[model samples]
Each structure stands twice: as structure tokens, then as C-alpha cells.
Target: MSKVVLITGASSGIGKSIAIFLTEKGYNVYGTSRNPKNIESFPFKLIALDVLKVDTINDAVNFIIKQEGKLDILINNAGMGITGPIEDTPTDEMRAVFNTNLFGAIDVMKAVLPQMRQQKSGVIVNVTSIAGYMGLPFRGLYSATKGALETITEATSMEVKPFGIKVVCVAPGDFATNIAAGRYHTPVFENSAYKENYQMNLDLMDAHVSEGMDPIEMAKAVHRIIETKNPKIHYKLGGFLEKFSIVLKRILPDRVYEKMLMNHYKL
Candidate 1:
């Protein structure tokens, strides 16, 4: 039997591309999305799943195991971006963002670990982001969410290594995907300290997406890691600038970087 690979957030962007690439390579791919009915027809199975709900994670796994008889890989990729100025971002928004990014990924990881443990071999790739390593202007929440996953994956790797499981937190830089296709969650906050600043940043972020790297570029990296005999703790992939940005973040002072962002965006 072809290795069974299950991908969460498989509807679009990096998730969908990975599914297609892996499927073409002969892995029996199972994709989970909050809206399973809308998924296009494919050789693999599609199951309804909301990673925020632990039960949904369970069902997705069970469905795959029943069909494939074994699970070889789990790619936690379902998440959303919460973009706005940090001060203007509502408390509820922060909770909701983490609920989806950090908590949701954790639920899926817990759900799949049992099966993977029993088999004593499996590959887990958490779809983290460049935000995890360094902060982005007006993207504090999004950065925080991915950052949480980065830390979680680190501790998780050590615990699961003894069980013969390989865990990877793959952080991608800007990728041209529907995620950056547009910014939809605009907040209509009443008079606030950061209202105008927030709008300007949103516009800038949207502009960034319009000029980002292709999402397929990220998918290819994911496929390579899954196929490899062993994967690294973290894979920071993409254009050379991504690496340089992290390096700059280390040397630059806090306010110096803040001024750079403000000046670039003309905030």
C-alpha cells in the first residue's frame, strides 16, 4: 500500500498543493477541511473537520485509518491570519486566533500521536511561518500564533523522538496563496489609538500578499521533507531575504526596527 498521508487545511494554499504533489507521487492522500463538501474530487478521501474541535480531529484520523489501514504522515496546516495593530486588536480576536492556530494544531497532534506511536514510525510537519521566528509590523497576533507552534513543536519533537516519530516545524516566508489573496477580517473598532494605523497596515499587508512568493514553492519543500528518511527540527525555507531578515532581527535594536517599519509603511 502507498504510504497514507493526511493533511489538515488541505483545501487551499500550501495544504492543497502538498496534497496534489503527494498524491501524484503515489501516497494515498487524505485531506481534512472545515468544509469537506466543497472540496474538489480527488483520488484521496475528504472529511469534514474543524481543527478547533478536538472531536473533528479524531474523526478525521479515524476516517483515514479505516480507509488506508495505517497513517504515515500528518501535516498540521489549517489556520487563519489575524492581522491588525496590536493595541487595536480585541481580546476576543487574540483568543480566537490562538484557538485556531496553536490550540487547533495541538488537538490534531494529540489525535494522531496514538496511531503513530503504535506504528512506531510517522512524520509530522507543522505549517509554521516566518512570523514564528521574527515579528512583522501589525501582525503581532499572527506572529504570536505561529511562534507558539514553533515552541510547541520543539518540545514535542524531543518527547516523540523516543517513539520513533519525526516532527518538523516548517516555517515559510511570504508565499503567494489565498491566505494573502486578500484581507477579509477588518475590524470596525470605534475611536481607538491605532485605528488609522491599523487600516494603513492592513493595506500594506494586502500589498505584501499581492507581491509574495508562490504557494507552490512551499508545498514542494513539504513533500521533500515527508519523503526524506529523516527530517530536521525546523526548516526555514524560501527566498534568501527570509534568512537575512531573521539575521537582521537579531542585530537590530527594538526601537530601531520599529522605526524602520513605521518609515517603510509611512505610518
Candidate 2:
């Protein structure tokens, strides 16, 4: 039997690439999207789902369980990004982002855990970002979602370890994807704190995505994780710059890192 895996947010970008690659590699991949039927016909099955919908998530998992008999891998790749200062980002919008990014990952994980527990083996990967570990200005809330995901991954990994389940977090930096264009860039403030300091930070984020990692880089990383018998707790990948940023953030003092960020992004 081919290994059965389910991926969310599989309509495009890294998710789409991973689906295509894994399918070619003989995994029985089931890809979920908001408009699954609209997707062009392919070898893998398309599942109609909105990650935010609890019933939709349940139905999709049930369908997979019936067809595949057991679920072996789950790629919690569905997420949304928003760009704005944390203070100014509206409450509703914050939940909206969290709904798809954090809550949705949890929803799917909950739905899939039973089968994995029964089988006594499985792997779950959450595609977080470098910002998940280190915060940056003008993207406080967006970073918060990924940070929460990384935390849940850590906690969940330890909790599920006894069940022979592995949870992995992948923090890739600035992949070439529609996430930049899809970013919800609301005029998040009328009278907000740090209003004056946000200009350069926003510009830095824009430039970083415009010329950063390719989506395939992320897809390849996903492939590597899936093939491993025991994947690491966390994986970080991207170009030289993103890896260096992660390292420097670890070594440099808080004030020193702040200064380096200001200098690097010219803030």
C-alpha cells in the first residue's frame, strides 16, 4: 500500500508543490482546498474543505479514513498572513488570521489523531515561519500566529510521543509564493502606537518576500521530513540570509539584535 498523507491548503504554492511531488513519489496524497472540485483533475484526490469549518474538516477526514483505511502523514500547511502593527490590527481580523493559521491546524490535528493513535504511528508537520521564533516590527500579529503554532507543535510532540506520533515544525523564510500578495494589508491604525516607526519595517517585509526563497525549497524540505523515520522536532530552511538571521537572533543580545535588524533592513 502506498503511504497515505493528507495536506491542507493544497491548491497552490508550497502545498500544491508538495502534493505534486509526493504524488509523483508514490504517496497516496489527498489534497484539501476551499474549492477542491475546481482543481484540475490529477492523480491525487481533491477534498473540498475550508479549514475554518469544523464540520468540513471532520467530513474530509472521515472520507480519507474510509478510503485510505489509516492516515500516516498530515501536513498542516493551511495558513493565512496579515501585515500590520499588532497594536493597530483589529480584533476581528486577528481572530480571522488565527482561525485559519492556528485554530485550523489544531482542528485537523484533532481530527486525525485518533487513527494515528490506533495505528501507533504518524507524523504531523506545521509549516511555520522564521518569524515564529523571532518577532519583527509591523508584523507582530502575523508572527504571533506562527509562534503559537511552533509552541503547540512542541507541546503536542511531547504529549503524543508516547503514542508513537511525531509532530514537526518547519519554519521556512520568505518563500516565493502568493502569501505576499495574499497578505491582508489592512490600514490597521488610525491612532496607534508605534505609528511613526512602522514605515521602514513594512518596507523591509515587502522587500524580503519579493526576493526570498522559492516555494520548491519549502516543498523539498517537506519531502525530506516525510521520508525520515524520525524527523527532528523543528526544521528551518531558506537561503543564506534567513539561516543567518536565525543564527544571529540566537547569538546577539536583545539590544544588539534590534540594532542589527534596524541596520539590516535600514529601519
Which candidate should be chosen as best, given lDDT against the real structure? 2
Residue 194, model 1: lDDT of 71
List TM-scores for all candidates, in order: 0.93, 0.93
lDDT of 2 by residue, 1-267 (tens): 888999998988889888888998889999999987677876778898788999999999999999879999999999988878776778899899999899999999999999999999999999898888777767777789999999999999999999999999999888777787777875735576665566656666777787877787778889999889888998998778777888888888999989987776566
Candidate 2 error regions (>4 Å): 188-200
Pairs with backbone N, CA or C atoms under 3 Å apart (clashes), candidate 1: 176-213
User: What RMSD does model 1 have?
Assistant: 1.9
lDDT tens readout by residue for model 1, 1-267 = 799888998888788888888888888888887888876776667778998788878987988888777899999998898777667667888898899999999999998899999999999999998878866767878899999899999999999999999999899877778885433364747777777777777777777776778877777898889878877888987678766777777889978877875676687
Model 1, global lDDT: 0.83
Model 1 weakest 10-residue run by lDDT: 180-189
Q: Which stretches of candidate 1 lie above 4 Å from their native place?
A: 181-190
Model 1 residue 76 CA deviation in Å: 0.5
